[model samples]
Target: QSEIPMQKPFQQVKELVMEYPVSENEPTEENSYLSYNLVVGDSLDVEKCTAFEVLDYVLLSEPGAPLKQALLDAGLGKDILGSYEDGIYQPFFSIVAKNARPEDKDRFVDLIKETLEKIVKEGIDQKAVAAGINYMEFRFREADFSSFPKGLMYGIDVFDSWLYDEGRPFDHLKKLGIFDKLKKEAKTGYFENLIEEYFLNNTHGSVVVVNPKRGLAAQREKELEEKLAAYKASLSPKEQEKLVKDTVHLKEYQDSPESQEALNTIPLLKREDISRKAGRLYNTEKHCQDTLILHHDLDTNGIGYLELLFDTKQVPERLVPYMGILKSVLGYVDTENFTYGELSNEINSRSGGIYFGVQVFGNAWDNKKTVHMLGIKAKALYQDIPFVFRMIKEILGTSRLGDEKRLYEIIARMKSRQQMSMASAGHSTAVMRALSYFSETACFQEKVAGIDFYRLLDDLEKNFQERKEGLIAALKELIHYIFRPENLMVSYTSDEAGYHGLEGEIRELKAGLCTEEIQGEPAVSVFEVKNEGFQTSGQVQYVAAAGNFAEAGYHYTGALRILKVMLSYEYLWMNIRVKGGAYGCMSSFRRNGDSFLVSYRDPNLRKTLEVFQKTGDFIRSFQADEREMTKYIIGTISELDTPLTPSAKGSMSLNAWFSQVKEEDLQQEREQILDAGPQDIRNLAELVDAVMKQNRFCVIGSEEKLQQEKELFQEMKYLL
Candidate 1:
C-alpha cells in the first residue's frame, strides 16, 4: 500500500469501513436504496486519472459491463447504476442499488468488495479494458457537448483542478496523451493495480443506505405545524401584531410593479433588431425501392445519425406496454449470431450505440391524429456505418425474444424506473393525465408511459409465471408486425459523402427487413380516467390542470406566447412560488389549443388549484408598459433561438414533418410574439377562462395531502 509514489503524503487507510445510514420518504412504488461509494483517490496526475475514467466504462457504465452483470446476478437490486464522478477534487466511484431493501445494505458493500477482489486476483478482462479505452477516447475526441456551449463545458472541466490545486487550470483537459499512454500500459496490468490501490485495500470509503419510510412526509408536516404553532404561542401580543403587519407589508411589496426607471436601465433587443423568419431544418424526401427516406444532409463531423421509423398502428392497443419491454429486450437479448454479453461488448467497442423505442407525435394540423412511430435510432462514425447496419439487421431479424428469465429481469428493472420517474417529475404525469380526457395523442402517451404503463409493468412482474407465455408471444408478434418494410421510413443525417454511402447500407439492410402480413385484426385503444389523484410517498405534489381551448370554441394565436410568459413569470410565479412557497410553476398554451398549468414540488394541493382557477382574472387585468413588454417578447424569442446540434436539427425536422407543422406557421407565430401588446394579453382572457373553467385536473403527491382534498378527485389510488 505504501509503495506508490506521490507528490505529498496522505492519511493512512483506516481499518474499519464507514457506513452512513439515512432515512427519507421514498415513493410508495419502490423499496429502500443504497449507494456504495469508495474513495478512489484524487486527480493528482493525468495518467492515473484518465485511467480511472476508462475503468468506469469497463466496470459498470457500459451496457452489460461485468460489474453491472455481477450485481444483477447477485440479486441485490432490480437496476444497478455505477459512475465515476471527477467534478470534485477527489474523484470517487459510486455503485447504486435501486429498489433495494434496507437489510441488504451490508450485502451491497460486501458484494462490491468481493467483485473488485475477484477482478484484482483474476485480472481485469483485457477485452473490456480495450473497449473501455476506445470508448473514452472516442467521446473526448468527438467533443459533442449535447446542447451546452463548448466553452461552458471546458470551464467546468477547468474547475476539476483549479479549485483543488493553485496551479494548472486546464489540467483535466490534457487527456488525449494520457489516454493513449494508458491504452498501451493496459497489457502491463495497470488497471488491476488501480483496483488494488483504490478499492480492495482502500478503507477511506463509505456505504450510504437510504431506507424508505412510509408516511414520513405526513409525520414531518405535523411536526412542522406543531413547532410553528408553539413559536407563535410564545410570541408577545405586540410581536404578533408586528408579525401581521410585516407579513402584509411583504405581500404588498410583492404585488407592486417594478419602477419604470429601473426597468429602462436594463438592456433591450428591439423588435426590429431580430429576424422575423424561422430557420427551417433541411428536409428533402427521396424514395428508394419500397421505402421512404428523409434525408437531412448536414455537417455532422463525419458521424452518421440514422433513424428507422415504422408505423405502429398495426400493433393493437393492448400490446403497447409490451413495446416498452421490447425496447429493453433488444440488443440485450441473445441474437442468432452473438451472445448478449458479446453483443453489448461489440457495440461499445465499435460505435456510439443503438436504441429502440415507440414514439407518439401529435399532428400539428389535426389534434385528433397521432403519428405512432416505432423508431430505431442509432449513430456511428462514418467508417463504422457498415458495422452499425449489420448489428441492426441481426438484432431485428435474428434476435430471440421469448426467454422467461431474461424478460423477467428486464420487466423488473423497468418497473423500478417507472416508479422513480413518477416520483421525481410527477408534473409531466399529471399534465398527461389531465390532457388524456380529450387529446388522442395524450391518450396514447398515457397508455405507453403514463400510470397505465406502470400498472402493466406491475402486473407482469407480479404474475410473471402465469403471463410469461403470453408476454413472449406478444413480443414475437410485435417484432414480426413492427419490423416490416411496408411502412418503413428512414431519416439520415450526415455529410454529403456519408449521405451517398447510406443508400448502399440501406439496400443491404433491406434484405434482412421483415415483410410479413398481419395474422389478426388490430384493436383500438380503450381507456378513459380523468380528474384523478395519484398518490405517492413524496412530500410535495405536482398539481396539473389542463383543457382543450379548441373544443371550448377558442382559436389559437401567436399572441398567446407573450401571454404565457406573463402568466408563468408574473402571475403564477408570485402566487404559486414566492407567496405559496412551491418550488416552481409553469403555464403553457400550445398552438393546437392544449393549454395546461402545472406546479412542481408544491406543499398545498387545494391552494395551488385555486390559483389556477383565478388565472383568467389575472389575464383579464393584465397591464404592462412598453419597455416591460419588450422583456417578455425577448424572453420568448430567446427560447425560440436556443442552439441545436446537427443531429438534433435533423431529428427536429423529421418531427415537424410528422406533426404537420409548416415554416410559415412558425414565422407567423414569431411575428405575432414580437408585435403583441397589452390588448393581445387581455384578448387571451377568454381562452384562459374557457380552459380553466372545465376543471379537469390530476395530482400526484403525498397520500395524506390527496386524502385531505379527496373530493377534488373522481378516483384516488397509489401510483404503482
Candidate 2:
C-alpha cells in the first residue's frame, strides 16, 4: 500500500446528483396518458431479505433514477415494506411499484426493457403466472367480498377519487376494460389491486438509492428522515386551503332545506316490503316534509312483523331527540324480542329459517334510505350478539368508542400476530375492513339527523338504567310485531328416519359417488376425551401429506410431513384399514389446506392383531426426504399465525366452539412455537402417536376393504 497520507492523501467525497426534466416534452393526444408497472418475486429466506434485495437490485440496476428512489425511500422512520409471504399460489410479488414516465421517454423506456429482459433471462417461471391466475380465481370463488361494508367502499372510492385528481398511475388496478371484466367475474384478482394499492402503498411508491454495502443503510435512514420532515412541513399551505373549504361546506349544509327536513325525521327499521314503498314529499314550515316508508321482512320462527317507517321532512329542532330515541329502540339485534342466537337456532332447527337486520344509510347530515342489503350473523358461542348489538347501537347513536375494551383486545391480538409472521394477504384485508367498519360506522348519520342519533343513544342508555323492564318490554313488543307466526315460515321434517346418529350425519346417498358409515363397524374409537388436562382435547385423524419443494426439486420437508400424517392415520387404524378390520384407511394430500397427515374413517377395532401387524409395513414402505425441509418449516410458520377473515374468523370460531378450545389457548400454543425447528415437528408427531392409540375413530368406508380382514378383527378380540 502506498503511503498516500504522506503525499496528498485525501479522498474527496461528493454526492453524485443527477437531474432530469419533469417531462420529455413528448407530444400527446388530448385526454391521453402513459402508464408503466413493475412486479418483483419474493423468496422465503427470511435472512435473505429477498424483498430488500429486489428493491436494492432495482436501484443498483438503474442508477440515477430519481422517480424510483422516491418511492422506495418513503419508509423514512416506519417498518418499511412490511411482511411478505412466500410460495403461496397467489402472487407473492407486488405490483405496488409504479411510474408514469411517458411512453416516448427514451431513457425510462430503455430502463424497463433492460430490467424485464434481465428478469426473464434469470429464469422467470411461467408456472408462477399460471399459479397467480389460478390463485386469483380460487380466492374469488371462496371469498365473500360482499360482506364488506358499504361505508368502506364509500371511503375507498373517495380516496381513489382524490388520487385520480392527483394524476397517479393505477397500473396495479386492472385496465379499465380489464377492471370491468374482473368486476363482472368477481375475480379474486380484483381484490389484488386493492391489496397492493393499500397494503403495498403502490399508489405512492417508494424510491431508494441502493449501494451494495450494508453500512450505508443507517446513513440513508437518517438522510431520508430529514428530507421527509422538510417535505411534510411544506404542506401547510395546502392544508390551510382545505380547512377554509370545509368551513364553507359546513355553512352551506346548515342552510339547506333537505338537511333541515332530514334532521326532523326519525328513522325506523322497517320490516315489510321496502322496495314497493315510495317516498312522498311535502311542503312544511321547518323546511320540507316527506314520508319515505321502507319495509323488509326477515322471518324467524314463523313470525313476521310490519315495520312502518315515517320520515318527517319538517318539525321542530327538538324532534331530533325523538329520532334518536327511535334508533336506540330499533337498532339492537334481537333486542326486539329474541337475541340473534335464539332466532338463528329457531330458524335452522325448523328447516330453512331467516333472520332480519336493519340499517340506515346516507351522508353525515341528511341522507336517504340505504338499508336493503345488510346481513348480520351472530354466533352464540363466540360472540355476544345482544352485547355486540348494544355496542353497535351505542357507537352509532352516541359515542365513537363503543366496546372499547373489546376493540383493544382484538387489535392487540392482531398486532401481535402481524409481528409474528407474514399473515395471509386475503385474510388481512378482510379483517382490517371488518374492524375499521365496527370502529367507525356512521351509516345512520346521513339518513336521520345527527342530533337524533345522539339523542336516541342517550335515551336508550338512560332508560336502560331506569325503566329496564319497560325498555325490555318495548324491545320484545317490536320483536313480536316483526316475528309473528304469520310473517315467517320454514319446512320441517317430523320423520325420525331423517334424524341419524352422528356417524351417519354426513351422507352422500344421492350423489354419483357415494360413501356410507355403517353401524357396528369396527372403528379405531378416536373420540374426544373431555376432562383431560390439555386445554384442547379433540381427537383428529391425520390423513394426508403435502410438502413445500425447496432447492429446485428437493422435498425433504414434504416427505417428513407425509410420513407424519400417514403414520398417524395408519397406526390408529392398523387392523381397521390395512388388515381389513375396516375399509380404506389411507392418507392424502391437500395443497390448499396447509397440512400433511394420515387419516382413517373406518377402522376394524376387532382386528387389533392384523392392525398391529400392518403398522410395520406402513412404516417401512415410505421414502425418505428428497428435498430441503427448511423451506416447509418456514412456510408453515408464516401461515399458522395469519389474521382472520369472516371465513377464517367463522371457521376458527366454529372450531373453538366445537372443539372446546379457547382463543387464548390457541395463542398460547402459537407462542410456544418460538422458532420452528425439526424438534418441534418431532414432538408434534410424538403427540399424534399418543392421540391415535387412545381415541375412537369413525369408519366411513366400503365393505370390500373390511370383509377380508375379518380374521384380524377376530384375533384382536380373542387377545382382548
Candidate 3:
C-alpha cells in the first residue's frame, strides 16, 4: 500500500498545458471558459489519508468558502470535479461563465488564482468548516446502504482493498476512526498548510482555456476523412482481408451462446434468495383542508421530506412550456426578502435542498385520464421544518419572475446544460420524443420539457429582448392559474414523531396559499406521431422506436416485463451494443403500456432501427431453457427488490397514490412475474410484431449521418 510521509509535504511539480477553440456547435456569442485541474500525483493510503479526503470534502462542500464566494461574485459557479483511487486523487475546479467575453477570461483566471492564495493564507471560515463537518458526519452516518446491493458493494470494497494491498476492507469501526481523526485535524491549521503545499505554491497544475471558434466541426470532419482515406490507401490487400476476417470473427463471437458452465460460473441470485412477500410498505394517511395531505410514516433519522403537488389540469395548454421555465427559475430567482445568492446560502445552511418540477403520470383508474402535477419538493431536518415551510411559501408567493437579467441568465444556463446533455443523453431525449406521439400525457411532456422544450428555450434565449414581455406575462398567467390552494396536494415522509410535530405547521402553511379556485380542467390536445430526425454535433446517434400498446387495447402484463428483460439482455445487447458497436441498448416497458426500444451512443441510426424492427422475429425464434428462464426471473425480482432511500420511497409512494395503484396491485404483479414461464414469453412475441409494424421512431445524431438518410424521416431538425 502507498504510505504518506508525515513530513516534507512539498513533492515534485509537473505541468501540462493545452488550449483549444470551442466547437462550431456550441453557442459562442460571447462566452469563453477556463478550467484548472490540480491533481495530487500520489496514491492515497486510505487508512492514513482519510483526513485528506475529509478535508477535500470540507473545502468542496462549504458554499460560503472564500473561493466559492469570489467565483459567484464574478457571475460564475464553481463546479468541483474529482475522482479518487486507492493511492491516487484527482480533484479539479471547473468555473463556467455563460456570458463571459474574451476580455473577461484572464480576469477570471486571475481571480481564481487570488482566491487560492487567500485560502492558503487565511484558511476557511470556522462556521463554514463546522457546517462542512456536520454535513459530512450526517452523510457518513445517515447514508442509505440499502439503496444498492449490499453484497455487491462489499465485494467491490474488498476487491479494492486487496488491489491496494490494504490490510482489510473498511468497516464501521474503521470509518468511525477516520471520522474522529478528521474532526481532530479540522480544528488545527492542518488544512491551510496542506492547501499551501499542494495548491498555492505548487507548480504542478494545468490551465485549460476553451474559446469559441466557428466551423470547428466541419474542419475536424474533413481532417478525419482525409486521415481515413490515407490509412485505407496505405493498407495492403492481405492486411485488409485479415481486418475483414477479424471483424467477422468478432461478430460471430458476440452472436455465439455462452457455454452452460460459463453461465453457471457467473454470480447470480438464486430463486430461493428471492422473497415472495412484498417488502416494507408505507403507512399512508390523508388529511383534508383546502388541499389534500398525503402523509407517510417512515424512519428518516431526523430528516424530513415534504412535497407539494399542484394539480396543473386547470392550466391552459399554451402555458405548458412556461411551466418548464418556472420549474427552472422559481427557487433560483430572488424572493421578496432575499437575493438569489442569499436564498441559496440560506437553503444550503438550513436545509438539504428545495426544487420544483412538473410530473405527469397516467391515471390508474381511467385509461383516458392523466395526472399533471407541478411538484415542489424540499428536504430539511426535523427541527427546521418551519424553515422548510417558509422557504416553500417564499418560492411560490414572492419569487421574482420579471427580473429580466436574472431570467436571461437562467435561460442561458438551462440552454447550456441541455446542449451538454444532448451529447451524453441524446438517447433519452430521442425516446421521449418518439413516445410523445402515442399519448396526451407523453405529448404534453415533450412540449413541456423534452427535445421540443429545448428548441423553445433556444428560441427564447436568442430572441429574449423581443419576447421578454410576452414571456413574463405568460409566466405570471401560469402562476395565477396553477398556484392555488384548491389545486394543492401535500405529501411528506418522516419518522412518526417528526410527522406529528410538523403536521400543524404544514396545515398552517397550506391554509395561507391563494384560495382562488380553478374553474375548469385544461383542454387536452391530440398529436400525430412525428417520425423525425434531430441533427447534432454528437459523434454517435441515439435511436428510439416506440409504440403505445395501451392505445391498441393491449394492457401491461407480467409477460411483457419478462419479455423486456430477455430482449434487453440478449437481443438488444447482442445486436445493437455488442455487434453494432453502440455503448448500450435497452428495451423498456412502462406500466402505462408505452414501450421503447432504444440504442445509446450508437454508430448507426438506420441499422439500429432495422435491428429494433427485427425484434419480433428475434422474440419468435428465441429459445431459452429452464435455467435461462430462472436467471431472468431472478434478475427481474432483484430489480423489484432494490431498496429506496426514505425520500425516494416517499416520492414513489406518493406517485403510486396519484396513479391510484394499490399495494395489492403490486403484489399481484409480483406474483404474475414469478409465475411467468415459456408460454408467457411466447405470448409477447405477437405484441412485439404488432409494435414493430406501427413504425414510430426518432433519431438524434450527427448532422452528417442524419442528412445522409433524411429520406427515412418525415421531418428533419437541427438542434443548434
TM-score of each model, paired residue for residue? 0.93, 0.21, 0.86
**Residues 615-703 of candidate 3: C-alpha lDDT, one tens digit per residue:** 87877776777778888898788678786888778877877887878888788878888877777777777787777778999998877
In angstroms, give how far residue 29 of model 2 lies from its true place.
76
Better of 1 and 3 by lDDT: 1
* Clash count for each candidate, listed in order shown: 0, 62, 2
Clashing pairs in 1: none
lDDT of each: 0.80, 0.29, 0.71
Question: Which tens-of-lDDT digit does each residue in 257-351 have in candidate 2?
Answer: 35435643744322221222221111111111122211111112222211222222222233322333333233223423444223222322222
| The best candidate in terms of TM-score | 1
Residue-level lDDT of model 1, residues 1-720, one tens digit each, is: 123343332354322222222123334334566777766677656676788777887887766677877888888887887778776556788788887776776777788888888888888888778777777777787777877877889898887777667577888898888877887889898999998888777766666767655556667779999999999999999999999999999999988977878877888888888888887867888888878898898999888888988887778767866787787788888899887767777876788778888788888756677878888888889889888888999899888787677788788888888877887788998998888877778888888788888888888987999989999998988887788777688999887788777777887887777776685445465545569997876678999999878878888788888877787888999999999999999878876788899999998899999999998898889787787788889888877887778888898889888887878888888888888898898988888989988878999887888889999899988775
1 or 2: which has the higher TM-score? Answer: 1
lDDT of model 2 at position 84? 31
**Alpha-carbon deviation at 440 in model 3, angstroms:** 2.8
TM-score, model 1 to reference: 0.93
Stretches of candidate 3 off by over 4 Å are 3-32, 40-87, 96-104, 115-132, 145-147, 150-165, 168-199, 212-236, 261-273, 279-283, 288-290, 364-368, 470-472, 516-523
Error of 1 at 712 (Å): 0.5
